[model samples]
Target: MRFIFKTDYDQDVRLAKHGGHVFWYGLLLLFLLASPWLLPEYWLAQLTFVLIYSVVGLGLMLLAGFTGLFSIGHAAFLGVGAYTQAVLSNMGWPFPLSLACAGLLSAAVGVVVGLPALRVKGIYLGIATLSFGFIVEEVLARWESVTGGNGGMHVKEPSIGAWKLDSGEEFYYLCLVVTVLSTLAIVNLLRSPTGRAFVAIRDSEISAQSMGIHLARYKTLSFALSAALAGLGGALYAHKIQFLSPDQFNIVQSIDLLLMVVIGGLGSVHGAFLGAIFLITMPQLIALGKDVLPPVIGQAPGLQAVVYGGVLIVFVLFEPMGLYGRWLKVRTFFSMFPFYRRGMFKRQKSFQKSDRLK
Candidate 1:
């Protein structure tokens, strides 16, 4: 095993802690930059979707993973961004401005939702968010004048001043840039005091409060920031599909977003991208499997849902740490080789302070 002796406090917060991280991440960046040229148009489009979902995943991870907040209506925020983008784009607004507005509007809505979140936890918070999502969907459907209701609305191609991202390749680059920036922003946030407080709260709210962290302020901030990222992703999704529908952002979509964070691995940045890849690619994989299976099994309308639920159950029972956590274990196993232990990554249970006092 390799170990780095830290000589300064800055090393603890450095983006690239060691030379290996720099080299590997540098290579990964180069590969991503060259992917358009390497991949076919269809695959490139799918990759674009992956990047967009990755942005949303990062946001959800921040809220759900770091802050221990659960949202069942995240799709509502996504819809808010999508509709906002569609409306602004149709009115001939610049892409950057419209995108920014989408995120801001979503964040504002998140704050509204977060206010109620202060009074609830766990299942109640989820129900509140879920109800908020339903309300947003209804508003989108009933507000025909603006949202076009069930008929949906076409989204204009994104443009930066005179430059239009009309082609799949151009749009892919745009998504890539946005995803990278969002990842960096989330990473930096996690390194800051605010991020530490979020983690503290996640581990134990009472302890965080005792440490002088304002629970309400940080929780609301987490919700706003998370919603903003989801909105940004929604804006991109609007352009990618070029159409907006209320049903597209309903409860099903929120559940999928939740699955992405959970399966991708909570509390790790890499989990967002991994989960996005799973989100975008799993459908295709299922379609391929359908070709090999019996028609009754393959053609069932609920096959995908069944598979998703089963996989989630398996992950929750066997690997609660998520894909990133699994990856860490595998990597550690290989590194440790003959000396690896089965209990190395096992969870430890702890009693509450009150229990200890008893």
Candidate 2:
């Protein structure tokens, strides 16, 4: 095991705490850079999607994981971003400008949603967001002039200057760059006072307020940031898919986004990436397994749904902290092998006396 000795506050808050972090992150970056050369065309497309989903996961993680504010209407923000990008690109806007506008529009909607949601918490907020999503869906369906209603709308390929990012490889690189930048931004945010305030609110909103943290401002900020990330992801997704549909951003998609962050590991940036990998790869793996299994098992209707739900249930029941959390436990266990305790990974069930009232 490696040890980190902090000599100063700067060293303590450094992005890479130890030499091992630098080495591993560098290696991961190198792998991502070379993935296009290593993987086939089909896998490359899947990887691009993984990167996009990771962006959405990061957004949800920021809001729910860090700020303790959950939303089930994130897909509505995604739809907003996708439509904004589509409309702007159709109007001949530059890719960068379109993307920025998409994010801003989505963030604006997020602030609107957060305003009333600030009065609620937990399940109530989730329900509020869920209703908001349905309302957005209806609006998209009726606004045929803009969203194209049930027929959907076509999206133009993103371009920079005279160069079009038309090919999968080009798009993969674009997504990679965005995903990397988003991840770095989140990591740095978590290391800042705002992120700490978010965590404080998560731990205890009352206590955070006692410490002079403005609950409404920070809560709204979290929603805006989360929605902006979703919008950015949606913009990329629209260009990648070359199509837009309100149905694509329905409650199911929102649930999938939720599952990604929850299964990846709440409150961990790496968990978002891990969750994205799982979300993209699991379906393909299931299909591959279907081909090998007996006809009855393989041909079962809704097998994908069953398997997906089962996996989520398993993760919730056995590994609530998700894949990253499990990995952390394994790493720690090995690092302190002989000293590891049996109850080390067990979940704590204790709560405050006030929480016992209801």
Candidate 3:
């Protein structure tokens, strides 16, 4: 009887795993690909923005979530990509070629920025990147020729042959496909041995070093990959808005990206999507809350900023793992149901101890 039950349980687990992989991915692919056809232009535009930042968020996740490198200045690379694409496209270059140039330019900047990582880690690395962001913002504001100075510039949409994608609805499909592909690419990369090495390095520099992983190489590789992805997203954003401005990609924007990564859940792949959505919609949501509430309870403008800051603080203070982590707990709890234990709220086990044990 015991042996029969064991066999049944193992078979059930295998079936569940198979179903999960195929069913979930199938749903995601269909939604991302078909969303433009299904939703109104408003929601489509919102989803496009979500996917755009999600590309950047995932890159940051790979760096901060997997490798323990918290980059607060990734906006600089984003600005580089946006400006490059804008300049190239304005100069009459083809869209695809210009987009490629944008990503490569950001990757070059990422490599240069990563050089300082050889001597710094943790908060110091974060400070270095933050300063880089400020410098980039200053350059963008000051460089009238390349960056268009404080006034900003326009960007042309991608076109090929007779079919011109001219509407938000049309751009929605392009953004969706690009986002889906980027997400899948990252997903595949993370499942490989290289991804595991990235996680191992995140767990412990000393331990990872002992295991023969070149810290400098993988670290720089993460930054380069992250910047490249951010650049791609920037180019997409440029097309989506059909405009470019230095103010759009500023230090505050970099901090907002970090907020998205944190609130969505650091390290979890799906959390990037969640983070982007929340970070984008939070102000709106909070405003709605004010309207929905009684007049006495209405949130003031200053309160919005306070609430935003509070959310970040609360997440970091109470649950450092972010929303996806909490979602996992909710899932595990319901999966077990009445048998759920109280300790479910403790914490998830990370890849390594001591490094980010707090």
Per-prediction TM-score, please?
A: 0.96, 0.95, 0.89
Colliding residue pairs in candidate 2:
none
Off by over 4 Å in 1: 347-358
The residue-by-residue lDDT of candidate 2 on 272-330, one tens digit each, is 98999999999899989999989999999989889989999999999887898788778
lDDT of 3 by residue, 198-218 (tens): 988887789989999998998
Q: What are the lDDT scores of the predictions, listed in order?
A: 0.92, 0.89, 0.81
Query: Considering every candidate listed, which one attains the maximal lDDT?
Result: 1
Listing every candidate in turn, what is its Cα RMSD in Å to the true structure after a full C-alpha superposition?
3.6, 3.5, 4.3
Q: Across residues 55-106, which tens digit of lDDT does each residue of candidate 1 receive? A: 9999999999889999999999999999999999999999999999999999
Worst 10 residues of 1 by lDDT: 349-358
Which stretch of 10 consecutive residues in model 2 shows the poorest summed lDDT? 349-358
Q: Is candidate 2 or candidate 3 better by lDDT?
A: 2
220: Cα error in model 2, Å: 0.5
